[model samples]
Target chain A: GAGVSQSPRYKVAKRGQDVALRCDPISGHVSLFWYQQALGQGPEFLTYFQNEAQLDKSGLPSDRFFAERPEGSVSTLKIQRTQQEDSAVYLCASSQLVEGGEPQHFGDGTRLSIL
Target chain B: AQSVTQLDSQVPVFEEAPVELRCNYSSSVSVYLFWYVQYPNQGLQLLLKYLSGSTLVKGINGFEAEFNKSQTSFHLRKPSVHISDTAEYFCAVSLDYKLSFGAGTTVTVRA
Candidate 1:
């Protein structure tokens, strides 16, 4: 892909329901990241993956937030028992280098609305 | 730990006029700085970054920023802006490959 790709550009779920968002990183990208952006706020880091290994998950807000990148190319973010506060944009980004100097390519993101 | 602070919540500029967005970061050690722009209904796009070397960094869409180590600031500037330049700007500091971002500043370029 020319850039990071995300599925289901928008989602609406009821309280207590579960939602899954998917991301397909660019070809040969070595690092993948997930972020959450609330309305009128900047994107906040949620998790990071170096290849298939999960290096950091400290940014995940709660136990209900989970992410996995089994193959290092595609990643999924799943939220269990969605709450009203969960309504926000879920973004996925990937970079070719593991170093912090390289720029991360971002996807359009999935806007989740919990009602 | 690293964190970023965007001084302005919003900035309004007319087309063909210059604009500046202020940003500051806090860290005990050396850090990587970045500026990202987000347009409506879209994802964030990298404006520029400061890793090392020259403090003046240039990026796409005629955007540039200067990284001042003394003041711990990375402010973005554009000599002339277009209506298309209206977007949300974010300042971030990278720590262990994770980015800590500021609240963001909304730039509205009017014609």
Candidate 2:
């Protein structure tokens, strides 16, 4: 695809249910980032990947929040136990060059609704 | 670590009127500032950025921002705004790699 693409534009899960959100970054993008955006709030960084290596996971909110990029093309963000507070829009962004100073192109995002 | 603050939670303005969105950041090291606009049901789009060189940076859609190092602020402005400019604006600062963002401000441009 020409731009970053995300799967399951909308996802709904019961409390305590596990859910996985997927992101397909632009082809040949070297840097990928995942973020969580709550109601009326800006997107918060969750994790970052440089190629196949997860360079930064410090932004992950908790142990339940896990992300991986096996082939360095697609990424997944898994939440072990869903909670009502976990409801938010999950955003995926990919940058063509290095992480620093390069503007990231974002996807439409997956709107996760935890019931 | 870097943190951002968007002072105005919401701003309502008339069409063709000028507006300003304020953002302030706190960082120990040098900062990279950015402004992103998020339309409804869409992801954020980069409005402008300040990495190095002149503090005044211009971006897409006639939007511009000034990076005030001493004040630790990067406020976005436009001479005149249209109804299409209504959206959520975010201010972010990157110290290393991870970008820390503000709470966001909702801008409504009434016709």
Candidate DockQ scores, in order:
0.82, 0.75
Question: How far out, in Å, is residue B44 in model 1?
Answer: 0.6
Q: C-alpha displacement of B108 in model 2, angstroms?
A: 0.4
Task: Fill in the DockQ of model 1.
Answer: 0.82
lDDT (10s digit) by residue, model 2, range B37-76: 9999999999999999999999999999999989999999
TM-score result, candidate 1: 0.98
What is residue A51's positional error in candidate 1, in angstroms? 1.2
List where candidate 1 sits over 4 angstroms from the true fold.
none
Worst 10 residues of 2 chain A by lDDT: A96-105
Q: Give the TM-score of candidate 2.
A: 0.97
- For candidate 1, what is the DockQ-based docking class? high
Q: After superposition, how far is residue A102 of candidate 2 from its true place, in Å?
A: 1.3
Residues A13-71, candidate 1, lDDT per residue (tens digit)?
Answer: 99999999999999999999999999999899999999999999998999999999998
Identify the candidate with maximal DockQ.
Answer: 1
